[model samples]
Target: MGRVGKQTIVFKNPPVISCAYSSVGPKEAAGPLSTYFDHSYEDELLGQDTWEKAESKLIENTIQGLLTRSGKNPTDIEFIFAGDLENQIVASTFGVSSFNIPYFGLYGACSTMGESLCLASMAIGGGMAQTVIAGTSSHYCAAEKQFRYPLEYAGQRTLTQQWTVTGSGYVLVTHGGKGPQVEAITPGKIVDLGISDTFNMGAAMAPAAIDTIVTHLEDTGRRPCDFDAIITGDLGNCGVDIAITLAHKLGYDLKGILNDCGKMIFDNEKQDTHSGGSGCGCSASVFTGYLYKQLLEGKLKRILLVPTGALMSPTSGFQGNTIPGIAHAVSIVMK
Candidate 1:
């Protein structure tokens, strides 16, 4: 593990993403990437009594499914890093507790997935761990009740509002695999442009995403075109456009190759997901399900995965505090 620039770290012997799995709800299953997801259930509750429990089950099931796909057991995992949108990250805590692996409950808002991957790569590259699992989850009902209002309220949603995805995704990171390798990571800074509208997450997170992208490119001595694609996690329609425009202003043109997991997970016209998908699961499921598959199939050689997040809690939002944005970039290269 070596520092590249101000916030970037380049792994000497990068960890390989040996296997990945995605489990999504019915709505996401009906979206554009339906065929890419590993599993989908029509029942959002997932046989659980509460939505929170269902989300926990989602993470548990995702991890189990990934292990099953990779032919590994819970005992084989050396460390587990996971998180969710729930307060105190209880979703990930309770979800993986049964596994009894050395756990690290992370909280990066929606960017928890990227943060988990960054740390997992560091642990493996720095010779701290041999095998690790990085995962995240989010639920529409749970997030609605926690962040905004209860599902029973039936409150009006603004046009800028984004639908929280009901899904979970997990990836197994190890060494010596015919899979994509985590080359480097750029940990982002907290950037607040003073946009406080809770419904408009895209506008809030765009600046941070642009900042991380610019810094990563400069640190790695590479341009946007150096990679096959540059993907952003959960930026939705509004944030993707904002980041692109901001990058252009910085003389970095990312017009054709910039893809957003939030936009790709759902069809705006067909799914009626107003702005787009925005949640931890929005990017998590898309990456493990769709993009990782592409990388393994040799469709994409190298790419930058930037997961953006809005650091705002219900208490802070109600107290009239501005939402700060952050984004972490994980550069992956396929062997």
Candidate 2:
């Protein structure tokens, strides 16, 4: 791996995404891309008593599913990098611990998907590991209760608020594989616009998404038109609009190339997901299930996947602190 610019890394030997798996809840199962997912549970609890354990089950199922799909055993995976939208990323830890694989737990809120992928690719490209599992999970009830209010409270949601997705997605990155390759990675810097409204996460994270995209383009000397699609993680309808307008003002035209996973995962109008979906699972499931399949099918030759995240803690919000935002870009190409 070699550093292309300040923020971007161009891999000398790119890692291939051998296989992927996604497990989503019933609400996501009813979404437009429902057929793409490996499994969808009608019961959000997944036979577990608590929402948190259900989320852990989602991650565990997806990881196991990825191994099964790839025709690989748990012992074959060199490392497992996973995270979730929970305190200390307990879900990922508890979910993946049984596999006995070397694990690295990550946390970037919704952007953990991209963060984990980028690191896993680096591990392969740098010869630190032959294969790695990168994944993330999130639950609607678990995240809602931890971040905002309990379901019992029946909290009122604003139009700008986004619905947390209940699901998990995992991808297997290997040194030599027949799949799309991770060509480059652009790690984002924290960009806080001093927005304190926790409910409007899309608004808080839009600028960060735009900033990271701009930096990636500049660092790689590649135009936005180069990729078949420039996809952002969990920036819902509001954030997508904001990012487009901001990019336009900054002399970047993201006309037909730009798409958002948050918006793509759900039918916002019919689903009543006010703005759209926003969670670690939002981008994870969509990319692994939908985008990866499209790449493998030769429908898309190149894609710039940028997962956006809001850096906010429940304590920080209660303390009246502004929300900081971040994003990371991973360039995937099929040859």
Candidate 3:
């Protein structure tokens, strides 16, 4: 691997995404891209007693489905990088440990999908691993319990608030495979614009997304028009608009190429999802399902997937601290 420019790393032997799996809740199944997912549960609980367990089940099912679709077993995967929005990422740890693969638990909040893909691709590009799985999960109920109030509380949601996606997405990446190539990655730095409203996740994360997107473009000496799409993790409606305006000010035209997983995953009016969707799974499921198919069907030649995250905990919010934001960009292309 070689450094492209500022923060981007161009892979000498770009990793290949062999297979991808997406499983979502019923609500998500009702979305525009409903037919793309591998599976969708009829209920949030997935026959589990708790919402947390349901989230864990989502992760487990994704791993199993990836292995099944790739014609591989647990032993074939060298390592699994996964995470969730739950505290300590328990959903990932408990869900993936059963497979007996080496694990690297991550917590990039909603950006965990891009973060995991970046590291997994590096593992292959660096000749350290042959096969790896990068994945993440999030559940609406589970996230609410940890980040906001329980559903039973009937907490009033602000218009800026986004609904957490109840789903999981996993990718089976390998050094040698027949699939889209992981060409490069740009890791983002923390950028806090002093926005303290935890509900307004899009606003908090837009600057970080813009920072990473522009940096990636500058690093690679590529224009926004070069990619078929520049997709952000979960900026919803509010953040995407903010990012487009901010990127224009930076001398980048992202109007036609830009879209957000948050916006793509839900219909705010129909779903009653105020801003749109937000959570680790928002981007993960969308990429694994809809975007991956778009690539495979020859609709897109190259695309940049940037998952943005709001680095905030309940404690920080309660303490009245500003929400710091981050994002990571992974460039994927079909040869």
Candidate 4:
């Protein structure tokens, strides 16, 4: 492994994403990318006792799905790195517990998938491990209870508000595979533009996406033309527009190349999803379900996957703290 500039790591022996699986709740199953997901449950509760338990099922099932898809037993895996939006990431801890594999639970908010991928790739590329898994999950009901109003409150959502996706995505990263490889990664810095409205998280997180994307380009000496697509985690509509406008002002003109998981996960005209989908699962499911297929099918040669996050807890927001944002960029190329 070699460091590129400051924030980016250029993997000398890039790790390959051997297999991936996506499992989502009913609402996400009705979205545009329905056919891409490996499993779409009939109910949000997933036959579990509570919404939190249902959320854990998303993670558990997705990891099992990955193992099944890759034809690898639990013993073949070295470690599992994952996280979620729940307090202390119980969703992850409980989800992967039955697997009995070594694990690393993480918390990067919505950017958890990108963060996990970065560390997993480094573990392989740096010769620390040969096979591992990197993944994340999020649930609408669980997030609502933890971060906003309870389900029965029937709180009216603002137009800028985004729906937290109830889904999970997992991938098997190995030292060898013909699948997409991690070429480089740029771990982001916390950026605060002093926007505290939780409903407008897209606005709060867009600047961090811009920062990581720009820094990745500068570090690797690449241009926008270098990638077939540059995907942000959950910028949604409001945040994506801001991202394009900001990129243009910086002379980067992100028109055709820029896209977001939030924008693609659902059809806004048909679905009542306001700004679009946010949360960790929004990007995770999109990548494992849709983008992974595109890369494997050779439809997309190169892409920059930057998962953005609004780094604020309910306590922090209630205390009138400004929302801080972060984005972790992973360069995935068809090999």
Residue 229 of model 3 has an lDDT of 96
lDDT of 4 by residue, 161-236 (tens): 8999999999999998779999999999999999999999999999999999999999999999999999999999
lDDT of each: 0.92, 0.93, 0.94, 0.94
TM-score for each predicted model, relative to the true structure: 0.98, 0.99, 0.99, 0.99
* Model 4: CA > 4 A from native: none
Between candidates 2 and 4, the lDDT winner: 4
Ten contiguous residues with the weakest lDDT in model 4: 264-273
RMSD, model 3, all Cα superposed? 0.7
All models, RMSD in angstroms: 0.9, 0.8, 0.7, 0.8
Cα lDDT, model 1, residue 15: 92
Worst 10 residues of 1 by lDDT: 170-179
**3 or 4, greater by lDDT:** 4
Model 3 lDDT tens row, 187-252: 999999999998899999999999999999999999999999999999999999999999999999
- The regions of model 2 sitting more than 4 angstroms off are none
* Clashing residue pairs in candidate 4 (N, C-alpha, C atoms within 3 angstroms): none
Q: Model 2 reaches what TM-score against the true structure? A: 0.99
